[model samples]
Target: MIFVTIGSIFPFDRMIRAMDDWASAEGRGEEVFAQIGDGSFEPRHMRWVRRLDRGAYAEAMASSRLIVAHAGVGSVVTAGELGKPIVVMPRRAALGEHTSDHQVETVSWLRGKPGLVVADGEADLPECIAAAAAAANAGARLATTADTGLIERLRHFIHG
Candidate 1:
């Protein structure tokens, strides 16, 4: 299964459609699930999650073989924390999917990092999925992450 998320901000039809195409060519029994706005559009291959519990999202994230996303910071941070292998495709401004092109910059940094894989588009999802599956199978270790003085530093900066 491939889990596709565009975060909670805006619609990302391009990423959605790309995953839909990937679902068709990848495997017969494979699943592609996406989170979109209003949830009206439908492609033959993929599934859309219109309204589901956060638990459902968490379950899918934990269980899915490959996690495909639109380069949102929270999602990327969570994936990194979970040590989940991710394939991120940035949301383009011209696509009318986001307020700014920060995702483009964000994905640019994330793609080269460990435990994350960045895909070009839906056309690349299948191959990316295979690579992700191989990585998952390989049992590679992700980085150890932590924030030691985040709150204290923030408070000091604010107060000072």
Candidate 2:
């Protein structure tokens, strides 16, 4: 299954709509499940709920083959910790999805990371999702912890 989540703090109607459309168009509606948050746009092609409890969310993530989510730190980090493949679409400030374009910055830094795919826009989601799924099938997986070099750099920077 493809698990689509937009986090809990904001309503991401645009992401939800794009996923729903993709599911319908690809005829993979039955394989997609979304935790849509408070989005007003109801998904017609795939199964969805407005919110998921922590346990349910964990279970969904554990069971899914590919995760689709907004570019939030928690989702991305959790996907990494679980060694799951994820496709991220940052919420845009100009589109009223966020207060700033920080998510875009996050995506830029994470673009080439293992097991992560960055979708530049809704138009790129289908291809991004497909690529992530294919990578997962080929045994590509994210790290479960921060790299030792990164941790050492942070320690040095903080101590100095």
Candidate 3:
């Protein structure tokens, strides 16, 4: 199963529409569950809900073979912790998806990281999804933990 999420704050119709179109064309027969947040476009090829609760979200992440998500740190971090293969499509400000291009910057930084792939646009999503699925099937694991030193520093900063 593929779990698609666009986070909770904004509507990412472009990503949702692309994924729907891709799924419809691919005929992979994989079950896709999407968490679309206030998006106007309804997915025709995949099952979707307006939002998922925390427990439901966690369950979806844990059960999914691959996670297709927006380039948001929360989703990325959760997917990383779960060792899930994740394909990220960043929301663009120019397309009215976001107030800024932070997602683009986030994707830029996260590319090449283990278990993470960047789909720069709809054109790249199919390939990225295929790669992610293959990697997952090959028993690839994402780097879930930060360096010990960084962790300690963060702890110290929080405690101090």
* Candidate number that wins on TM-score, 2 or 3: 2
- Candidate 1 per-residue C-alpha lDDT over 71-112 given as tens digits, one digit per residue, 9 for 90 to 100: 887777767667788878887777676778888888776665
Q: Rank the candidates by TM-score, best first.
A: 2, 3, 1
Candidate 3 local accuracy as lDDT? 0.92
Q: Model 3: which ten-residue window has the lowest total lDDT? A: 22-31
What lDDT would each prediction earn against the true structure? Answer: 0.73, 0.91, 0.92
Put down candidate 2 lDDT per residue, 9-56, tens digits, no spaces: 989999999999998998454589999988789999999999999999
RMSD of each: 3.8, 1.6, 2.8
Pitting candidate 1 against candidate 3, the one with the higher TM-score is: 3
Model 2 Cα shift for residue 16 (angstroms) = 0.7
TM accuracy, model 3: 0.90
User: Which has the higher TM-score value, candidate number 1 or candidate number 2?
Assistant: 2
